[model samples]
Structures are given as structure tokens and as C-alpha cells.
Target: MSATEIPEPQVWLDERGRPCPLPVIAMAKAAKSAHGSPVIAVLADDPGARYDIPAWCRMIGATYLGEISVPDDKGGSAYVVQISESAQTDASKSIG
Candidate 1:
């Protein structure tokens, strides 16, 4: 598959319409869609994500690979975050 078609989960936050938690929620949905263990990337326009994404990663026990800033032609920025496998699953869960 092509790089764009790699099947990685991607969440797009509404840049002009939503607020802080919405971006975080979007990231969560993308992570959840990974079926408990896959690296998902989230694209958000909210400044909150710079901190929120990493914080969420911590709460979910996922690895926050970090964020990249992509500038749009129109003069805005898009933040892409790489969520690691550890962040996707509840590794703390124990076998019964």
C-alpha cells in the first residue's frame, strides 16, 4: 500500500469550529479505532493539543512520539501527533 494508504488511523480536528477537549476527544476516537494496539496519528489545529495530546498519551499509557507543525498555504498550522502502541492498549490489564 502507498504511504497515504497505509491504513493508519487519522483524526482531523475542526480547526475553525471546535474547542480544546474536542481535539482531545478526536484523538481518543482515533486511538480507540486502532483496536487496542496500533500507532495512530492525529491532526489537530487546536493549540491545546500541543499539551493535551501528550497528557492524554500519559493517561492512556501510550507513547507520544511528538508533534510536527505543518503550515497551510492559507497561513495556519496543523499539528500531527504519533501515538504509540503502548498508548493504544491498557497494558496494565492483567490476565484473570
Candidate 2:
């Protein structure tokens, strides 16, 4: 999707300095808590995020809206995600 088409993040999860899978987990938690299809921005500096975030999004059926540069001394990157409505429903579904 085009950058202009992506909506601004409704929730920002700062996972900078955190390790690979942790950021992904944080994103999952954020998506689980949020309602509807909200845009979420995850700030992370770990190199793994470049691959992991998009992979996680795809695995969860969420839309990976691409990464944006974050202007800060830390020089962290902002990975954007569009949480699909089905994602929340799937998360709420109980395992049998």
C-alpha cells in the first residue's frame, strides 16, 4: 500500500532496545488489546525487526504498512502495521 494511504498510528509501542521476538510479542499484545482495525507503530532498533515485524504481520493476517524513519537521538525505526479486524477476533477465539 502507498504511504499516503496508511493511516497514522493509533497506538505506538516503543520496543526500542528490546530483542527480536520481544518486539513481535509486544506488537501481538497491542493488536490483541486494540479494537477494530487500528494502525500501530512499533519503534524498534533491533535489526531483526526489519524482517521479523513484517513476517509476524503476515503470519497474523495483519497488513504490513512498511517502516518509517523515526526522528530521534536513538535513531529508532518505526514499523507500521494495520491490524485486521479478523486478527482481533482470532486472538479472542479460545483454543479447544
Candidate 3:
């Protein structure tokens, strides 16, 4: 990782058995905790989470930093997503 890039923390939610919305919700909470300056790597096996995570980032004014698919032994895809800072007033004014 570069000095300008803060490596995100990866969380593997074993809720692959629970189904849709729960994984999305968990990812949202995780992202919220990593709200500023760093990203959160949300690895979810739920298919819905692939879309829901990015959508949540959009709704919350955070940057959807893209994702990578991870091979899982449990027979599902793992999504690596990065959530950037929220676009608050002070955040918007920063000329970087």
C-alpha cells in the first residue's frame, strides 16, 4: 500500500447461511465504523451483498472503491469492497 492509501480491514462474515439482507446490513455497520480515512474490506458470501454493499455506500455518500472476487472453500464468492469517507460539508471542502 502507498502512503496515500490506507489499507482497509477485512471482515469475513460467516453469515453465508443467514441469507440476503443480513449480510448487507452487517457490511453497512462495518463500513460505518470505518467511516473516515480508511476503508473496510467486507467479504461476504451472499450474492445480494455484492450489489447491496455498493448501493449502501452510494446512499451514505461514501466512495464505492470497487471490489475483487475471492475464491472460497465454502463454495461462494467473497467480495472485497472499500468504503471511503462520507461526503460531509467539511469533507467536501478539503482540496486534496
Best by lDDT: 2
Residue lDDT tens for model 3, 56-84: 66666665565544435665555445555
Steric clash pairs (candidate 3): none
Q: lDDT: which is higher, 2 or 3?
A: 2
After superposition on all CA atoms, how large is the RMSD of candidate 3? 7.3
Q: Give per-residue CA lDDT, model 2, range 1-96, as digits (tens).
A: 666676788898899989888898888888888988999999998999999999987777888999776747787799999999887666555211
Tell me the spans in candidate 1 whose CA falls farther than 4 Å from its real position.
1-17, 35-37, 74-86, 91-96
Candidate 3 Cα outliers beyond 4 Å, as residue runs: 1-11, 87-96
Candidate 1 per-residue C-alpha lDDT over 1-96 given as tens digits, one digit per residue, 9 for 90 to 100: 234433443544444346688777776766655653455555555677678877877787776655444434442344444556665554233110
User: What shift in Å separates residue 57 of candidate 3 from its native position after superposition?
Assistant: 1.5
Error of 2 at 45 (Å): 0.9
- Cα TM-score per model: 0.58, 0.86, 0.58
Clash number for each model: 1, 0, 0
Clashing pairs in 1: 62-87
lDDT of each: 0.56, 0.84, 0.56
Clashing pairs for predicted structure model 2, backbone only: none
Q: Which model is ahead, 1 or 2, in terms of TM-score?
A: 2
